[model samples]
Target: MPVDQIPIGTFSRITHLSQKALRLYDERGLLVPAARDICTGYRYYTFAQVERGIRIRHLLWLGFGLSEVEAILEARERGDAGTIREHFARRLAETEREIGRLHAIAEVLRTQDPLNGGFRMSITEPVIKDIPATRALSRRERGVYQEAIPRMIGEICAYVYPADGRQPAAKVTGPIMFICHDEEYRETDADIEVALPIAGSVNLDGTAIGVVTLPAGRFASVLHTGPYPGVGKAYERLFAYMNEHRLVPAGPSRELYLNDPAEVPEDELLTEVQFPVEDLPLSP
Candidate 1:
């Protein structure tokens, strides 16, 4: 209540925080008391400390860690405007990323309807075309019924598109897809390629793996958009489509990369979902 000091309980009240939380903050060096009585050893916070406590509470609400909050507060105390500005910029970037993820979630929810469900599967006859033997700067991973594969594909795309001077072409084409090297989990080694159709040999550091001639055939293809978990649902729809049409997939289902991770909105990622297959013969 006084200018020089206030009771811990009063400080907690002014800061709108629980005593337990206040104590934790103090222990974490987030908000230390201004003084303590020698005999009673009771914590006392200066009136100014109340304002700092309130600031800490607000920073915590913004998802800053105690250390981050302390650093920001220290910068303020030192009148270091540049450090404050940098912290805010970093916070803004983090906030934007969080918003992007939430927006992707919202988009998936909106597209869950049958009319525009997450996947569009269609069957077509085999056709032949000449595709340039292109080099892909890829990163491979084990996808076996795991969500990590999708992220690996994205990281690969991000690495290639921006770092390799291939981003411009990435804007024109489709959603990214995965190329499965084996059947299901039997061949546990899943090598996913983030392919960009380049004109010539691009100096890439990772293993080239091998060339896959995507044979043109009667295939059931689906377009999967959005992030990892959402793509799983799309794969489900593809399987359902095959079941409904009595189609038997002839070869390993492969994903065709159509968007650069660095440039495309992850929600709107374009992937050509291709499955080599043959229609089940009509029963006599």
Candidate 2:
């Protein structure tokens, strides 16, 4: 019972940290009590520990892990402002990325239809057409779907536009398109290819970037105009049409960007969704 030692309950009240959390922190070697009665095994922390306890709670509130909190505490003990700055800068970047992801999720939720309990239907009708074979420059990558698509497209455009002396691909045969190779919806590690149709070939180098031919085929297509997040509804409509018409998908799905997103408002962006299909006989 040292005069400087504070009982666990009193320390908990002072720091606003629950007894369970204090015990867990002790178990994790994050915070150790100043003394423990050998007979009763009751924990006691010093008055000075109250400041550390409060700091730990604040760090936890800021989404820092136990290890990170320990590191920050160690940096403070050493009076290393640089280390603290580095840790906080890294955390700020991570928080910004999380915020972006949450905004994207919110956008998707906003576009859902309450009646259908699904994404709002955007396209009323889809056209069936035969697409001609074409050659193009492409870049393929695997990453989070919504976040990765735009970045990959921008990288491809950056490389292609300047490599060709700022000239638009001769005749620019078709709109910029993305071939979705994944068979099912994926939140991460989606297989995507960004392609630009060129009337003539240009030399390009890179393992992930190259020239490739897009196969010609009959496709069931719909035009979706609005933010990209609402494109899911267009896919729902396309699949429904395919099921009703008894058509089987023959190849990967494709999305043709009809306008530059950088130039138009997100709500006004245009995209043409196409799914290659094979026709089956209608049932009597």
Instruction: Tell me the tens digit of each residue's lDDT in model 2 across 17-69.
Output: 99999999999888899899999999999988989999999998888888999
256 in model 2: Cα distance from truth in Å? 2.0
TM-score of each: 0.52, 0.71
Model 1: ten consecutive residues of lowest lDDT: 121-130
Pick out the ten consecutive residues of candidate 2 with the lowest summed lDDT: 115-124
Once all C-alphas are superposed, what RMSD does model 1 give against the true structure?
A: 9.0
Q: Over the stretch 6-105, how does candidate 1's per-residue lDDT look in tens digits?
A: 8878877898988898878878887878887788877888876777778888988988877788899989989999998888887886677668668766
TM-score for predicted model 2 compared with the true structure? 0.71
Error of 2 at 180 (Å): 2.6
